[model samples]
Target: MESLFSTMIVLLLVSLSCFTSSEALKSNKGNITIKWDLISWTPDGYVATVTAYNYQKQRSIPSPGWTMSWSWTSKEVIWSIVGAQTTEQGDCSMYNENMPHSCSSKPTLVDLLPSTPFNQQIANCCKGGVLKPGLESAFQIAVGNAGDSVKTVRMPVNFMFTAPKQQYVCGPTKNVRPTRFITADKRRVTRALMTWNITCVFHKAT
Candidate 1:
């Protein structure tokens, strides 16, 4: 009777362990994941091209649905937004050949004032649509042209992502208005950020 009781207790413990393991798997099923990559960076006034990939099997996710802010400082030069492009496919047609081929607006080269924090809404940046999984999307920001002055600076950018509130089954031609993306609760959204610096060197012909 003692041996039989011991075996019964062991079986009960094993069953409980399996139940906990199954719960863990169920909780993580069909969850969305985000992957970021610094695709390319050129010191031509430090153009940083970054890419974001959705790793889930479902539909794409919305970006900066909550908040995205960046700031910078430089002693001798000012940072500007010369050109930018955001799309679901990682295409560089607009940013190639040292010219903006397909941007909606011309290169503005807006200045980034010293010690001043800037938000996406104030910058008037275009809002990107849903980015499908297995396919990647990219954002490219070009600063001012490289000059003779030697300078090194860091630009810190932070943003969040969330599922879109409105669901539409339509073609890619749907234009996403920037106003559609209002600032959301930070506590409820997913957050990520990156900071990269650039050092400019001016070389003179001998």
Candidate 2:
């Protein structure tokens, strides 16, 4: 009889533990995500598009916009960018001329203003980092001194996302299937060379 009673108590504790663990997982589910798609390989490195999506039903990222920062796992530089630009051009003194956009191992990027010239614009870009619920913003980047192929490329780490009075916790990047796109004429289809995703969950400030 005592053995039976002890078994019941252990089972109850296990059930409660399972329930709490399940709830914690649900609460950690991401509401925002960033995706990086390697569009094509360059002679020196590659060109890719980075997009941020806000999946929250009612939340939005307002003006002065989102700022994202990450540390390259290897010696990488931003040769050029479109639709958005890095906040600083870290010491390109090594290059004599035609310097890269940013040389910082850890770079911060922000969206361009709406008044940006038409020639400098790309689809879903230049919104000044103002993201609406269920919408996305994207920017293209030319990375230099990095791997030209998927096997050699390294993913950035320590991704930090910031918005007005909001905090987001970003998860480690996960390599995913390539992204596919249909031509404007709908006659041809193409896919990215590689793709990865980083999800961020909004945590209310205490």
Candidate 3:
């Protein structure tokens, strides 16, 4: 009778362990991460890279999409996107042509693979992503709210990340290995602050 009781206790412990493990997987779903790296500034604008990674364990699949929003605190300066490039180049886009301030797109799809780090370079309002002295002065006057002068301007840029998509198996209802898209927590976003030293030159009061 004692042997039988020991076997029953072992079965009960196994069942509890399985249940706890399943709950842990469910709790890890929205742990995706994104950040800015490799930021180098130019007179025109800065070139930097943004990267996103999947931290979900059970769903271990690449993210379907991610987005970034740009806004600034400088009342005297304006920020714009000159261009951008992604790791999966064609898989992403600044789809909102009307509002290039924000960029959003889905990445290439694959099966049973760790998520690819989505990378992009954000450029300022300079031609060919370069800001020369003369061009820099022009951009300042065009976007700057403060009067033109030989003053040092610091533009603090804020990048807000949002709308992350997680890819996972949809089960037998679709196919042998069907992937589906699910919205993730918008609160899982990250931000970057960049300041540009813009020199504004204006003609003297004649």
Candidate 4:
């Protein structure tokens, strides 16, 4: 009887341990994810769209909104951007004409205001960085100096995202299946050349 009781206790402990481990794994899954899609090939490099999605059920990114920064793997430059803008246009003095938007290897970007001109806006953009639960914001960037083809282009690294009062831990970029887009008329379908994703989880700042 004594041996049987000991065995039962051990089984209960093992079951509890497994339950706790499963909960921990679920909690570690992030609430925010950022996706980068190479939509088109530009003469110099490529045009990509970066989108941040808020998956939290109750939380929302309030005004004075989110900011994202990432380091380029190579000497990539932002030729132009729509739906968002860099906080600083690093030194563009090297270009005599057709000035690049940002020259910094690590560029910080913020969403455009709602008052931004129509020509400067894109769908689901210019939201002032306020993201309600289940909503997403996106911006398009034309990158120069980076490779133009899938075999040559490089992915950015070390992405960092900041919300009004919250901090997030971003994961490394991962190559994912290309994204497909359908026209408004639903008559045509197109797909991105390549796609990558960076998932970030909300961690209360210590």
Relative to the unseen true structure, what is the C-alpha lDDT of residue 191 in candidate 1, on a scale of 0 to 100? 21
Give candidates' CA RMSD values in order: 20.6, 7.1, 22.2, 8.3
Predicted model with the maximum lDDT = 4
Residues 60-131, model 2: lDDT tens digits: 899989999999988899999999999999989999988999999999999999999988988999998999
lDDT of 1 at 66: 15
Scored against the true structure, residue 93 in model 3 reaches a CA lDDT of 43
8 Cα displacement, candidate 2 (Å) = 33
Model 4 regions more than 4 Å off: 1-30
Off by over 4 Å in 3: 1-30, 59-64, 75-206
The candidates, ranked best first by lDDT, are 4, 2, 1, 3
TM-score of 3: 0.27
Across residues 81-117, which tens digit of lDDT does each residue of candidate 3 receive? 2233222323114343432232223222111112212
**How does each model score on TM-score?**
0.31, 0.85, 0.27, 0.85
Looking at model 3, the pairs that clash are 44-131
Count of clashes, each model: 0, 0, 1, 0
Write candidate 1's Cα lDDT for 88-120 as tens digits.
222335454554322321221221222234343
TM-score of 2: 0.85
